[model samples]
Target: MGTTPQAGGTVAEPITLSTGETVSVPLSTEATVYGAIFSADRPAVDDLLPRGLEPIRATPRRAAVTVLAVEYHRIGDEVMTPYDEFSVMFPAVEAGERSWPFASLATHGASGYVWYLPVTTEPAKALGVDVWGYPKEVAEIDHDDHVAGRRTTVTADGQEVITLDVEAPPAVDQRQEGVSYTVKDGTLLREQLTLDGRLGAWPYSGQATWELGDHPRADRLRDLDLGERALARLRFDGEFVIGAGEPVGTV
Candidate 1:
């Protein structure tokens, strides 16, 4: 038998970048996550993956502030249906810090947004979009025709950046596997699911669009008939940081 090192004792090496700078990252698991980030689902430009760079221990110069969209696609013998799924997590930087104003919105069926300020001047408007949550799994009837995927498109002044990525499944066909972000111009999109071989192509999807209106956050959603059933059961836990820092790294 071979001896395996303890989990915490296993440290990942640092990676050198083209700009002569380096970053060190700590992986939540031993599995390689970079491969999923660079795969077809979340494609990256050439040199995007620095030489000897690995996600296990790679840290960006700045924290990432992104708007991610998780969409699920279900393929069936006769019908193709899509659902919106989401999960929000603060990175290591903002884990224990005070919650700031990050823009946020949630719709019942499709697209939504979380607008965060990262920093604020007024104390009264301290906690921006205090909580947010998304569905974990999109269900499937036969396990074969079901597929799920997500896409996170981020833009600043309508311009795109190249650092953020979607956490997608490595392979497009694996039943449990999902594709992470696919970067085009500046958007990161990912989808996961199993194809029953019924359709020749992917079906149209939906997004949960959320924004502030005349009423409060709760009332705003109600006006649109979004998620009137289980509003209380929704679990949205995350915080925003407002300061001088970069949201995501640049290539």
Candidate 2:
């Protein structure tokens, strides 16, 4: 593993494993999360994946575009400073059933294939990509909580990639669970993430928009022809946990 140098004083207090190996994780935390999950479907672009790894679709022409802004209030076992993270992912399954994406709208169904994940901290970026194969990169991500809602932007090398605007009204108490997939060492990894908190259904009320910028990453999404109306909008304010991921197969 490469050395993940923590930005001065931002290093959380060390956590020792059973074998005396210290792990990087929070003991507990409170973070505000806001995002949207739109849809995209271009036959030419959608057909790019292998049949075995079928993309999860809303309709024949609609694939999920998920954008997020997560603010870790104080990650250090409460010792390190705080940082915000932004990510863009396509909710995909292993290419099997049509009932999967709907499960997220109803219950915990299938997971997603995260194509791009970017974080504000350099150490987290290194760990996310080098350790977990999470297609991670270091970028400038910011989140501002306003009376209307949360505004988020992700930029790389000073170029804005995408921006999201979602009006957050009073949240409705909710509990949510979902799975995500990633590959490492030729093995399929499934990560189940859960959030037990409050939600504001901004998309249902027509209060959201996704603006893809001119950056390459943004252009990648543009190729998919994401719809103007998000198929799903995720506005969560509560406890978020990425469960211990286990290897599912050597695909």
Instruction: State every prediction's TM-score relative to the real structure.
Output: 0.18, 0.78
How many residue-pair clashes does candidate 2 contain? 1
* lDDT digits (tens) for residues 1-251 of candidate 1: 23223224444233333333322212111111110111011112111322221111111221111223323332111112233322222111111323221111111111111222211111111111111111121221111111332233322232332112222232332112111222222322222211121111111112222222232322422232322111111111111111111123221
For model 2, the stretches where C-alpha displacement exceeds 4 angstroms are 1-29, 42-52, 98-111, 202-205
TM-score of 1: 0.18
Q: Per-residue alpha-carbon lDDT of model 2 for 140-225, expressed as tens digits?
A: 88776678788888889888998888776567887666777777777667766666678665434466787778789888788888
How many angstroms is residue 73 displaced in model 1 relative to the true structure, after the best TM-score fit?
A: 34
Q: Residue 124 of candidate 2: its Cα lDDT? A: 59
lDDT against the true structure, per candidate, is 0.20, 0.63
Can you tell me which runs of candidate 1 are displaced by over 4 Å? 1-7, 27-154, 157-251
